[model samples]
Target chain A: MAADKVDPIHQFHITKILPINVGHYDVSFTNSSLFMAMTVIAATAFLILATSGRSMVPNRWQLVAEMSYSFVANTLRDAAGKAGMKFFPMVFSLFMFVLVANLLGMIPYFFTITSHIIVTFCLAMLVISTVVIYGIWKHGFHFFGLFVPSGVPAALVPLVTMIEVISFLSRPISLSVRLFANMLAGHITLKVFAGFVVTLSAAGVAGMAGAVLPLAMAVALTALEFLVAFLQAYVFTVLTCMYLNDAIHPGH
Target chain B: MASNVNTTAEVHHGGAEHGGAFPPFDSSTFASQILWLAITFGLFYVLMSKVVLPRIGGILEARHDKIAKDLEEANRLKADSEAAGAAYEKSLAEARKKAQAIASETRSVLNAALDAKRHEAESSLSTKIAAAETAIAGIKAKALAEVDGIAIETAETLVSTLAGESVGRDEVAAAVAAVTAK
Candidate 1:
């Protein structure tokens, strides 16, 4: 195995430059940052083109655009209730951005930010932070009471509250891990099978004949991964909506 | 063929065991992950809100308008059909009434024609009866005159034969008067 391939953790690398050091943090942009910027620009251009003309009766492109809106809108309404409307734009933007990113990652040689755990973790952290801030802002200090269930006996309050707080704190870790693991696993699976096709073809005639099954499997898995990509984005958005619901209506 | 060969290679080598790609978590990997997460989140936010949601809403509203217009058109057609049905019924009834009036008129005309024919036939029959009565009266008068001449001849022959001699008219007249008296 090559030196680069032998290093287990070295697969994920971050290069830092001493361009201009901020007071506390290293805010230098990297390849990942560049792709993130590209994703945003691409997303903006896509929407602008889709809704260039505001027709009463939408064209095929506009129809697709509207369906995406209603799907997210209804999802938020169902999961988060009337208060969800306040965060509709946020949740909508989140779904669209993730969906595009995941789809873009499927393209050859495109950098899939979602495949990285740090990317997923950061998003989860944002949601968790928003939940905490919104909860405290809406309920004041009483937001701490969220960990204590209503109608519970005083004797169990401490234990119950500890459990609730642990669960709440674990949100970012679990959310990030779920998405990162799925994206990473799916892509790696495709690559390994792809690698087999090359290696087998290079071998004898028998190896070439044997490559057909894995190639077929890889094709099927790729299609499935596409579905998974869409589903994960949806699940992430729904979870965000549910968490926002907690902030909107605490105590339960 | 190559795809098949690749399958055996991946299976034999344990494709899932590509463990080098993902290893234990470390500080650098963690930081990179967070940075990517922030970037992706921001990108998604703008795309959905600005582009996707509005387009979806427009489609839904347009569909709703289409459905509503279709229903309105259906209602109008139903009303028109009902009106047409009523008009058809009215016209049918008027035709039936006109048919009945024509039938009654025809019956009256036929009856009047029959009465006039009966009256003409009766007048012609009465005129023929009157003409026959006049002819009979004329024949009866001629026959009475002839009978009077033959009765005188026969009486004369009978009186001569009975008296065996020529008898005068006064004697015959007296005999006829006696017989009449008796």
Candidate 2:
């Protein structure tokens, strides 16, 4: 069996589709870009087409559309109260994009956009920046008060403040890494198991029988990946809501 | 199928090291990925906030308003029916009172009329009884006078026959008078 020869990480390779050179930057359209566009198109089409009827009693498609909208809206309201709703569009976009991208990645030979740290990091950075900018804009210098724990003794204030600031700043790093690592690990695990099935089945009758175990495992992992896809999207959006809450109401 | 798998595996192995070590770590595609991400996400956000969300919100609002209106209409109708029921009960009570008054009035009038008729019948019966008693007394008195005359004649005849002689008129008349007077 050539199990060791199979490379699971090979699936994440990016290929250039259309090259666009701008003086110093190599901003060529890639497979990741295509899937990202597809995600946007799918999300937009679902929302627009479903709501076309706008019936008081919604159809199945309209129900799905409404559920997605309210899901994010309610999440925002719960996490940050009514004031957090102002960022609904941004949060909704992030959720749908990540959700679709993760699901698309589960398809054989499709690239998982969220698996890339660059993409997830960019999204996380966006959330963190929005929180900081909006917090400062709304609260002025009082935004710094978010670092100081209210009940802490004066002697330990400096230590607690430093730790708080560090934790607050680590929000984006942790958020982006969580989604990226989950996708990357899940996809790699599925690929490794699938590769085992392929290599074993090529070895003859006994090997083909042995391949069944990995095949079953691959199938199960695929199902788990689907769940992780949804869960990660939820986790990402909810964390974004909590961060936005800090922007709206600092120090708590 | 075996060859296909072999070739794919070969390509994967061949591509692993040279193509890029962990494609995400390759800094080359980050710019394009971020660029397209921004573009796509921006467009999605705009469409959501400007069009789709508002439409859904409007539909929900419309349904809520319609339900509230229907509820209000139902409440109003219920109130109207209750008022009508109250009015019907009031009229029924009034009618019953009116009927009772009329019944008592008619009963009193009938009782008065019956009493007057009974009094007239009693007075007429008493007068008729008095007249009948007077007539009966007159008849009895006449019958007694006739019986007395009869007795006196019979006695005179019997006395003359038994003696076998014609008696003198003054003696006979005196004898009849004494017998009748005794």
Top candidate, metric DockQ:
2
Error of 2 at A165 (Å): 0.5
lDDT of 2 by residue, B33-146 (tens): 888889877887788789877887788788889999999999999999999999999999999999999999999999999999999999898889888888778877876666
- Per-residue lDDT over A1-252 for candidate 2, one digit per residue giving the tens place of the 0 to 100 score: 243335687677777799898877878888888888888787788788998998888999998888887898899999999999989888988888899889988888788989999999999999999999999999999999999888889999999999999999899999999999999999899989988987898889999999999999999999999999999999999999999999999963
* Candidate 2 CAPRI grade: acceptable
User: Which stretches of candidate 2 lie above 4 Å from their native place?
Assistant: A1-7, A196-216, B1-19, B85-116, B119-123, B126-182
Q: What is the Cα-based lDDT of residue A163 in candidate 1?
A: 95
Error of 1 at A205 (Å): 2.8
Root-mean-square deviation (CA) per prediction: 7.2, 4.7
Predicted model with the maximum lDDT: 2
TM-scores computed on chain B for all candidates: 0.60, 0.68
Model 2's chain B yields a TM-score of: 0.68
